[model samples]
Target: MGDVEIRPARSEEYAAAGEVTVRAYDVDGHLAGDVGYDTVLRDVARRAEQAEVLVAVDGAGEVVGTVTVVLPGSDFAEISRPGELEFRMLAVAPTARGRGIGEALTKAVLDRARTLGIPKVVLSSLEGMRGAHRLYERLGFARLPERDWRPFPHISLIAYQIDV
Candidate 1:
């Protein structure tokens, strides 16, 4: 209900953002109960340089959500071309749901993509995340055929593309 600000993440905020990721995924049983803490830490370190990580902070400056946009790279080879931006991770604090934080973060990404002259933004969402799917659909993203995309671990991913 207070002011929500989205900005480029600072190096010191990685740990907090990781915590948000763990808690968000854990709520849906996507992560193991004993998932290692260092796992996210290492991931943050590895991807920080190659991605644009944005954190949403509340009026008090507490991190409440995070989204990472990874430009087309070796890891994002599934994307067709250079004009597309890939959204890697998007997580909102469980307590922050329904507050428009997720939508704000998503808009920030799209805004950045437009500023960078990217034509489209692509993201993969787990099939079970119905609310997230709806959000994407509301934002003008359509479901791409499964045959056109592939995500990891055999978990079917619903792909969405939004023109910037």
Candidate 2:
């Protein structure tokens, strides 16, 4: 991860970060049969307005991965409680996979939570995203099965949380 830098995305980089996010999800088949969510994934600027939009940039400064960090009560936050920070749309470009960009970005979120004096960080992931599930587990996130939910008839999201 030495060549990657995780930081809050700049206004000028919103389009690039959004494209990286959309491309990652599209490549991973996470968007199949899902219509409108793609628009949400591509709206980094709007999310940045209400949440923190963080990007992983390679040494040359290309946005290769992005994640949205939502605080309690934000429109982008789904399952987060008052003391928890929720992250959404965690994505790493297919071409940039295996480079630890996703893990680094997630760690950055955890660091952000600690910096804000937040106790826990939470997130929702599709049940089929086994790779991400493994990563979350490796980072000590426990499943909150009782919080699992379906936003749309075809979409089922599982929750996870880790105390920071």
Candidate 3:
């Protein structure tokens, strides 16, 4: 595995994170049809102030992956329960896949959740992302019953919860 450093995303790194997000979700051109690059960047930037946005930087200091953890708030209505944190917008660069960057980012988020005394972490993934689904399951996340809370249209989402 390459030397990976996971850290809280800085405002300057928003562009890099946006690039990674676009590339990672470009699988079969799904994200492009739903959300453009500017929208993703704007949304991520807005969320950074309230939530923890972590980025995985390579040895060269380039961001190759990112994950956002949302604390309980009005923005995350899907997670109505208490003592839980929500994760969203997880993405790894195409070249950075299989290099443990995603796992490292996830571990960082879970670590922070534990430090915050949050008992569980929740996330919703696109139904077709089988690899991501498998990784979440391997990391002890259980699939919850289907819900109608997805933000995107024509996309089926599977919710998962993991105890921190």
lDDT of 2 by residue, 28-97 (tens): 8999999888898888999999999999999998999999999989899899999999999999989999
Residues 74-118, candidate 3: write the lDDT tens digits. Answer: 463355367888888889999889898888887787898899898
After TM-score superposition, the amount by which residue 17's alpha carbon in candidate 3 deviates from its true location, in angstroms, is 0.6
Predicted candidate 1 versus true structure: per-residue lDDT over 89-137, tens digit per residue = 6888898888998898899999999889989988887677888888889
- lDDT, candidate 1, residue 44? 58
Candidate 1, overall lDDT? 0.77
TM-score of each: 0.87, 0.98, 0.89
Runs in model 3 deviating more than 4 A are 35-38, 146-148
The local lDDT score (0 to 100) that residue 149 gets in candidate 3 is 57
RMSD of each: 2.7, 0.7, 2.1
Whole-model lDDT per candidate: 0.77, 0.93, 0.79
Give the worst 10-residue stretch by lDDT in candidate 3: 33-42
- Candidate numbers, best TM-score first, in rank order: 2, 3, 1
Against the true structure, whose lDDT is highest? 2
Superposed on all Cα atoms, model 2 deviates from the true structure by an RMSD in Å of: 0.7
